[model samples]
Target: MDTLLANITYAGGAVYIFYILTAIWIIAKKNLKLLSIIFPILALLEGLFIDWRWGRIQDYGENAQIVLGALPSFIISIGLPFIGFYIHHFITQNLPKDPMIDSLIEKSKSGAFGNDDYPSIYSLLESKIFEKSSYQKAIQNVENQKELINKMIAVLTDKKDDWDWKFNMFNEYKVVFTLYGTGGSYDPDNGTITLLTNKSGGFMNYKNPANTIIHEITHMGMEYSLVRKYNLPHGLKERLVDTLVYLMFKEDLPDYRIQQMGDPKINDDLKSANDLESLNSIVSKFVNK
Candidate 1:
């Protein structure tokens, strides 16, 4: 019985040490400072209790020398927690920082996506407050989009679809085809459409461009329905809009191929969109009035 108890106690001590060391390593690698600090203190308590349990069990079988065997356990219990804390501090202070993550954290902390703050999609579209300067390039985009809009309106006008859709003023948009992360937001509350793109190279092919217009336009159309049917949170509503846009636009692209990859080239990188064949395939089947 005594031997069994000694073996169990020794195993427990080994496990505790393993957990402590693993936590310390993660603290160093992931730079989880708070977790690192807290875990070490818990580890120390665990170590002390384990040693105490082992000492009590061992006293019954063998007179283990106090200074050589027991003193090391006590020292580790007292010192290891502080060592973990300091290691965490050093890791946090010395770790290389990512500016993008920092920016996101800052934005999150400041309530950047709050209801009262963001601009409406219509307003953003009208203002053309994009980070671009060339009016000619933007005007070309508008002209190309106008043709697509006309085609979509024609398609829908003939079909007796359930939804009432129209261009009231041309606020259609697509996410920036760039590497930056701004393309995927749809705010239901403010009716804002935030797109991220780097449009330096050139606009997407006109044949497929119309699909992009139809995509965003579809989102706008759905927002009206969602606004009437559900009082969803702003972020969730935005995501819903993105999903709907992607689904519809996938039918409008030239080859019926969807671009699943991402790019850092701003508006130049066209995301996966529906091809013309798919749109024609789906729309032709719809019975008209």
Candidate 2:
């Protein structure tokens, strides 16, 4: 029974050592100054406890026997924790932030970036639309929207080649005309894209004909499940990407300035977000509507 008790005591000491080392590694890798201070204190306590228990074991044998039994306990209780903590700290702090996570989240939001990639009449005709026309003027307008969509996709997706993107179109269509403007939804799964031109807000702008088209394209890129959308609010990865999209394209969209629509400090506030809650706060300021 005494042997069993000693073994168990040593094992417990080792485990505590392991935990302390892991914490130390975490602090070092993250350069977390506060944790650095706390870690040594914890390690000291663990060492002290091990020493106290090992001193008690001396009653079982001569000094040499007690020393032999206590050595393993000292190594585990005092050494392992330091090693684990530093290892964890090194790996975690060095891992790169994921860009794809941000892309997925930005794509989920409805905004100008999402609305930037519209197909040109020429390209659509080559792929989906058929026939040439004496209506040269309308064809020219279609080409303009296509350019706008390409630029928007480039800015939002962080890809330079708009023409390289994959696209498919659904044969059916649905549309909505609201007081704010006309809008539509596109379904990528079924290859269907819809348009609702507010008789007043159709693709008429020479400067950004692609805006509506790109917006609908982005909607099509949404993940098929509503559960994903609902759960996204709880995550940080998407928010970071979405934040990147807005920051990259804000110059093209002066009307949607953070200062005009949100607290002037909104961007600054987001710079500190190392996780999803921070990202969410930034997104809410811009896209909660």
Candidate 3:
């Protein structure tokens, strides 16, 4: 009888070790469904095995002693899996949804922008109090500005399907051109792209506005997918956006401009590479697939 009990205890211990190793493997691979199934099995097996082994111990042979000592461990082991499952469920439930993209799709469905209309660009006039007429005058070159806008649209929409869904969401979305210092920005909250007209010495000065416009729009798209959808960290989000932009516009834009879009930490050589394979390898470290 003692030998039979010993064998049972040994087998249980072996199973427990296997469960621990499997749990680690599943966790490392982020196999959440498998983890959900395995953890409960682990708890059940642990409780049974631990109870049987403890039952054979002379100190825990008495019913009162067994209830006092063994019951707590069994309860704890069983409760742990329940707690783990709850945490897993809570995290998955609370994962971020892209509010920006959701709003854009809803706005599109409601016909906020006309069916055939594309995204609009508007010049933000400076407040009368801070009247700077030069900035206002820069945007007045309507014919030249239209030419630049059309060229940018052509470059960005070459493979229309790549961005058609996102662009459709922003049919009414506006790019607010401003003479507010250097660099452009996108506001996910309002679905607006604010381009710094002063960056290349205002609208008339841009040799190619497509470079900057594409960069800012890339940010807008990534914010919807990566930032809002996946809830990626800021550093990883920037890396992915820069890598994608580099891939898309490598032919049209200068190497330096592409490098400027990437994370400053990335080696300049890698960021400026003409090949997509090298660039993708760098981006894959932060984002799988």
Candidate 4:
């Protein structure tokens, strides 16, 4: 314990690990020039804060000072992610224009969903992929909602009328209707929203795919950037998304409701539309604790 505590590298790797991950994030975000400049300043401030805190440690218990030093590191931690998410609100992203909404919300007739790639839990329960009639009918029903769904998505987006360009880390978003899955899923890596067109909508208040599309779109908007980052419980993730959706779109989709899936505890942070705006930082606070 003493050896580890004595070595800053041993006990304070968070700031360093933060540096590497942040560099990757800045590079991936492709705003190297601006973010790179700010990062150095933030890093310098963090270093000074840590140094000052470390120096103030009592002669007998250096660990006390070390922990104090670590406290300010969180400032930089908070600063950078806030910058990233804030940029999303102001920047004009590369999402599809209207009329191109079809391109964003199109149909998938292919029965070969590479079901093996996903877990058995995500696979369809009652219907098979080869159910051509079900698949096509599902596709048409989903497409019919594309126009209204596109509008409802505005509230889920960064701007009133714009789509979340980097939502789920994918630039372009599309929905895939298949007879295989139970309800719906949004894949962040590929920007694909998969919805089960099966007649048997098993759970999560999934009466139909139209509302389910909005739900998954909500998930796509938040999944990686917020939910997974905090290692949030699945139930909490669903609840937060459901709350955001209900707060933003319950009137448009009258049947919309927050299913009893997520941790009711998270409700403390997500009661209104105002809370939705600061969701990233709010969730970020979880790890700070």
Candidate maximizing TM-score: 4
The digit string of per-residue lDDT tens for model 3 on 1-289 reads 0101111111223353354345434544555676667766765665455445444333321111101010111111222333454455332211112343234334545545332322210111111111234234333432234444444445444543443134322322234444322244455543344444432245422455455555656667556644565566655565656665666556655541433333555444354424333543444453454
Candidate 3: where is the Cα deviation over 4 Å?
1-129, 140-145, 151-169, 203-207, 259-285
Give candidate 2's whole-model lDDT.
Answer: 0.34
lDDT of 2 by residue, 200-260 (tens): 3333222343444444443443332221343433123223333433454446543322212
Candidate 1's displacement at residue 193, Å, is 5.1
Model 2 regions more than 4 Å off: 1-140, 155-182, 190-192, 198-207, 222-245, 255-289
Question: How do the residues 80-131 of candidate 1 rate in per-residue lDDT, one tens digit apiece?
Answer: 3335544553321111123432343345455462333223322322233222
Candidate 1 to truth, TM: 0.30
Ranking by lDDT: 4, 3, 1, 2
lDDT of each: 0.34, 0.34, 0.40, 0.48
Candidate 4 lDDT over 1-289, as tens digits, reads 1111221221223443344345434434557467847775755654454444345333333111111101212223323443544365332222112332122122111223233422321222112212334344445555456556656654444442233223442323445443332345555543445554443422334555557767776786677677777787776787877887788877888888887886576678777776666677766665476
TM-score on alpha carbons, each prediction: 0.30, 0.28, 0.38, 0.48
